[model samples]
Target: MNTIKTIAARAFLISAGAIFYINPAWALLPIQHWTEPSGAQVYLVESPVIPMVDVQIDFDAGSRRDPAGQSGLASAVANMASKGVMAAGGDAALHENALGEAWADLGASFEANADRDALHYTLRSLTDPALLDKAARLAARQIGEPSWPADVWPRDRARWAASLKEADTRPGTVAAHAFAAAVYGSHPYGARTTEETLQRIGVADMQAFHQRHIAACRAKVSIVGAVTRAQAQTLVATLLARLPASADCATPLPPVGEISALTAPAEQDIPFASAQAHVLIGQPGFARRDPDFIALLVGNHILGGGGFVSRLTNEVREKRGLSYSVYSYFAAGLHAGAFTVGLQTRPDQAREAVQVSRDVIARFVAEGPTEAELRAAKDNLIGGFALRIDSNKKLLGNVANIAWNDLPLTYLDDWTKKVEALTVADVRAAMARKLQPGRMVTVVVGGQR
Candidate 1:
């Protein structure tokens, strides 16, 4: 186990009589990192508090790498990596053991979020040295040597396809699909995996895909647990040793943007389904590297990202009583992704809710946040910054964001100061530059436009 450091917080009262905290100077929770011989980027932070370790490997083999006409190929490759990789024994025993321990697990996931960049594999284990070794080995094997059993692919494909079919009947999912396509027409980020794509994928295809995308250079490794810096390095090296050399096929990701508004209305009538409707509206916003990232984050918090305190929630739900909830957020992915606003309402209230949401967004674009709103947003953001890095998992996530986005090391340290210094002018300027109400792509599900 390694020594863990504590972070202190200092609080003060603002003019509005609200208590807020100034950034505290705490011992650095240093993210010790190095590139493995195989070229995999490795990061580690030790916490002796709990006898557990969480490891994540992010790859460039996201949806962008999918072949044309095979919209969901990238997802299929990511999903299949876990089905008895190179090893003979299946995941059955592993699954049961995970349930028993309630502490260890492994998974392969593809997040095809618009504008975001990578897919990832996550392995978690208890501090027991043996368990940690086994988990890391298994993760490495899954990425490096998936056998893709012929017998298993059929069952997995059938189940996955059926789930996709089921989701197609849901209005919320439909709206999301349409909105993504409208926002990212020709860009790979907009592609949605379908049943046909899944059916066409074979073991060879997955193997080839992994070989090309899951290179050491593309891997972003994150670790947080009861281990020292030395142990962390050994763990990463031992697990990733088997991976093949980096491939020359890796390419820089391209940016996605739209000059005008894109709109598409998709209607689906699920026989005898419930009496509710869902809608989504959005457009490309900012990348993680944007200088105004924090500014927009605070702005979105006041717009629709924050729950009760956001302007969208207040106007759409509290003031007019239109929908249960309405929220907006921007995801800074490998490229700049959409700024999305979404809501759900009773069938009868759908139109009113959509109208109200648009009206509020338009007003926000024009007026930005008031001085009072800016003050509250700053206080809340600065005060809450501590909570964001309170846990190992969260700390690992922060490190991953920093490494993946190529951000400065001073980011986390300077977070509060950045938020605290934001003024009305900053928020208003960010709104004008990023928020695009008229150009937003809107999708209404289970409702007539």
Candidate 2:
């Protein structure tokens, strides 16, 4: 019976060609749309096999909304929401009891990422109808009405401050923070939370941020899992009805202009540490909606983007043995995000490592991938595409990304075809247009250069 099922599934796939990575028979369905009474945009997807459901509600309440002096308010608001709610009892017991009743994992965890235009609050859970009810109630109440539990503020703030101080002591952290500031300049994207920022994060600030940003007006809900259409509708409705009306909810996402070259020199003397130092060089790259995404994606694979076979890894690690690992990648965002090249090596070899990495990037940008590299990159990318979309978890993540970026629904279906369609000229054009080594922000931490 199992063998028959396997053969049938494979046969179905073969006949269905390439409509979907799984269940080719399952037609490409539009993202079911419905507006909640409260006006939150709801997106529902049905996959009724695992007898479970995953629910997500996001708000434009990202850290970008943090006021000038209060850089951590959005994070604090998100954190406090789940810790307590207006459930069976007050917030503390509400959280404790919810955990006792069923599994509750923090999708956003305790981390805070604030961009200039938006903030995000996300949660996921298994589908037990009863648990679903409780979760919706809890999530809605938290987003709609949150009161910071006493004493939690000072404790969490202390921990946050301590972590920031500790992160300052590490080379990698130093490089990342410095890179953001260097690349963004006076933009809010470059804002960093210091001890002063943390100290100024009052409970009133969190309340104010939550009221303004976590309102129903900015909500976008997505659910994809083992949920029936009826169940999906109910789930979305439950979430939507709990949010506020969409008024004045539009958050601004402005473009980041070209950033100046930046260099930050810092030293952390760690006793009894390895004599090696770490280096990171980067600059702002393309936005999520850039037309050259496919070209850059394929081209980067041949450059320092891919692991063992990347140009940077080959030149720095394999050829010169300057480091054990080196690589580069472009992080696409709402705005031009980051194009970062990273590596670790001995202090004495730091300068050589930085030079080689920069040279590789420059060459790739000037000439793009050779024909052979481009072909391999396309073939590898297209062939591996299925493996990337083969699971529910991966598909869910893809859908979230699509909705987040407002990508067309047909993106996944035509992605491989688009990648394979690129010519070497396309790659060269993309590389030249995207990567600028001289304008890059470079940071070398540890060991004397």
Candidate 3:
């Protein structure tokens, strides 16, 4: 499946809730990190349990780098990558269908996507020497020699525009779009992909974005599988060989500013005909790099992140029956992301539901959680830590996170301890520092009268 349809599906299809704990012997091995000769930062975990390899290469070319008029440029570029690779040396060019068949023949696969903070390309293949070599070379070409077939863009653009129009009809999509716009203001994080924006993007824009933001030096490669340090280095060198060589991290690219903080509370009420009103309440949360990240984690659990056991669920769902489901979470990333509380109830009860959620958040942030609540939060978080890295893909993701955020190499092993070390006072202090109930933005789409 060389097409964007199949590649995008594989990129986003993540499994949830492992039935067994992640094996400490393999998953918990200390990470080995170093800078490669090509200037890409590499993090490796040698787990020989399976004769397979999973590699994720991340670049700082996510949606945040998209041009102003082309909000979906990064995503479009990543999708076009799978269309095929240009020919070079003595080899003939391969079409999308032929390229997909090449990977299938070798029992290997690759996928690419753009998240809020980075563009991710993942390759998976058996550790067999011949197969691995073919997979790596093919992946390198896709990363470096994307053709951006002109014939493909017109058809794909129309498909994308139609898809967005269909998705826009849902209230949930409308609510999320409004909430993001209100919370992120001028930041690129708030940018939305509309039919107009998609129409403005062409194959030329995709090629330009790829050229400007993608380079060998900007790659952060994370590998988890049966590979030694020397082997990994050689593999990385081969993978990035075709890309443009440029200055490393020492030479900064265009700087994306930190998301601006909100000044006063803003509320938007929209009119719609629906049985249930979609509600979103929140403000900018801390960045993943924030020193108080550990404290914020534990506090959010006690506040509303925990499912049935959270304060939001207890007050808004069980206590008042205002909504059947309510949850809160922090989307911390390179910059401060949104800390949102979302729920849906009858259109008439939307106001009460929003008010109840707001009150719960204000009280939790102001007073912090109690001693008992803190213990429970810690217990739940620490108890299920193993489930987070149950598979090779999950382990690769965590390694990638640590690498991208410049987190300590021991971040995974220290996660439970950090959660366990937090005291009630620490949580309270961190919450007080990170959240401002008075300045939050409230967004209700198809809900508020």
Predicted candidate 1 versus true structure: per-residue lDDT over 1-449, tens digit per residue: 11110100111112112212211332165667787766677777766655566677777667777877776666777666655545333543233223323222222121212113677766665555545665566666666666667777778789989999999887777777887787777777787878888877887887777777767766778787678978887877766665776566357544334333345433333222546677787787777798889889998999998899998899888998878888999877766677888888776777788778888888887888999888988888878877787665677778778778877766787888888888878887887898767767667767643
- Pairwise lDDT winner, candidates 1 and 2: 1
Q: Give the per-residue lDDT digits (tens) of candidate 2, residues 168-233.
A: 877677767776777767655677888889898887788767666666656666667667667766
Question: For candidate 3, what is the lDDT?
Answer: 0.86
TM-score for model 2?
0.83
Expressed as tens digits, the lDDT of each residue in 1-449 for candidate 3 is 24433433332232112223336545459899999876789999987656668999999999999889789999998898899899975556887998888877766789999988899999997766766787899999999988889998888888998999998888888889998999998799999998899989988888878877788888999999878999899889988887877534566778899888899999988777777899999999989988899899888888888889999999999999999889888999999999999999988899999889889988987888999999998889888877788678789889998999999999988888888899989999999998999899888878757
- Sort the predicted structures by TM-score, highest score first: 3, 2, 1
Per-prediction TM-score = 0.82, 0.83, 0.93
Which wins on lDDT, candidate 1 or candidate 3?
3
Report the C-alpha displacement of residue 166, candidate 1, in angstroms: 0.9
Clashing pairs in 3: none
Candidate 1: segments with Cα more than 4 A from true spot: 1-27, 87-116, 249-274
Candidate 2 pairs with clashing backbones: 61-119, 62-118, 62-119, 84-91, 85-91, 216-244
TM-score of 3: 0.93
